[model samples]
Target: MQLSRFTDYTLRVLFYVAMNNDRLSTLNEIADFYGISVEHLRKVVHALAKSGYLKTFRGKHGGIRLNRTPEDINVGAVVLQAEGAEPLIDCSGLDCTLSGVCNLQRALADAQRAFMQELNRHSLADMLDNTAMKQRLIGKAV
Candidate 1:
């Protein structure tokens, strides 16, 4: 199942913040790095803070940081919350005669379960463990 843009942005914010855990990261900086709208990131950051995943500070030197450690933040938990409760495939919207008997939906559901299970095996830190990826994503030598 493909993740929504909102979820993608949520993960991006988490990744960038976790990488820069030594200091606070501003929304404008993250937006500039990812080439995404700062307005959109404002919403994302607000939600993340509300969800207890991030802590935000306001004022002249205000920015954001992870409220919890990188290892404490589960990748699957983040995705599940960001993705919401919507089903991967909305077969109810279509007018198919085999809707009741189709195994495709079940198969897809199982696949999604497996996908999340794999993601559950890793944490935010796991994704940033690669030296090259860390350097590239943080855009600095580490």
Candidate 2:
């Protein structure tokens, strides 16, 4: 199963923010650091802010920061919010036209739940320790 670009970028943004810790990261800073489009990240940032993951400030020194601790930001919850719904293939509540009852929907739901349950076991804090992500983006973090 593939996730959307929006969800992908949102997770990237969260990782960068979690790494910065005390600093209030700017949209441009993250966009530049990740070499992503500022315009696209602006939308993602706004959505994250609205959803209570990050808080934004307006001023010369203004920027964004996580509203809660990284350990508190459950990956599963964030994925649900970013995806805007569960990634399940719902056939229908109605009886199937097929003679045999297909368990496709039920199977998909179970798989999706398992995926989320794994995510729920961790937080943004857990992901930030990823060495490859840090090295790819920050180059040894001077």
Candidate 3:
């Protein structure tokens, strides 16, 4: 199934925060660092903050930081929340015409559940478990 840009950006933003660790990373800084659009990243940051994934502050020293440790942020939870919709296939619906006529709905639901269960097996920290790889992503030691 195709995931939305929101989920993609959520993962990227989480990785950026994980790379910075304790450093209070800002939207502008991350946008520049990744050469991405600051405006787009800001939306992702806002959603993350609203979901309790990140903490935000105001003023000259204001920035974002992880509300939980990288280990605590489950990849599946992040994706589920970031995507903001059930991973149901086109056949899924409360009153789906094919609900009882076809098996696709149940099959797709099972697959989606399996997908999330697999994702739950890993965390943001698991994405870059190696110190060298983590450093490479951040371009420095945290």
- Which candidate leads the pack in TM-score? 1
Q: What is the lDDT of residue 71 in candidate 1?
A: 90
List model 2 lDDT by residue over 1-142, tens digit each: 8888899999988888777757788888888887899999999999999999999999999988889898899999988888866547766665669525787877888898888889899988788777887666455222
Better of 1 and 3 by TM-score: 1
List, residue by residue over 73-138, the lDDT tens digit for candidate 3: 999999988775564766544776666688776788899889989999998889868887676667
Task: Extract clashing residue pairs from model 1.
Answer: none
**Total clashing pairs in model 1:** 0
Which pairs, if any, clash in model 2?
none
Error of 3 at 30 (Å): 1.1
Q: How does each model score on lDDT?
A: 0.88, 0.83, 0.83
Query: Which one is best on lDDT?
Result: 1
Point out where model 3 deviates above 4 Å: 90-99, 140-142
- Give TM-scores for every candidate, taking all chains together and pairing residue i with residue i: 0.90, 0.85, 0.84
Q: What is candidate 2's CA lDDT for residue 111?
A: 91
What tens-digit string does per-residue lDDT give for candidate 1 at 50-130? 999999999998999999998999999998888875667779879999978999888888888899899999998898889
Q: Find the 10 residues in a row with the least total lDDT in model 2.
A: 133-142
- Note the clash tally of each candidate: 0, 0, 0
TM-score of 2: 0.85
lDDT of 3: 0.83
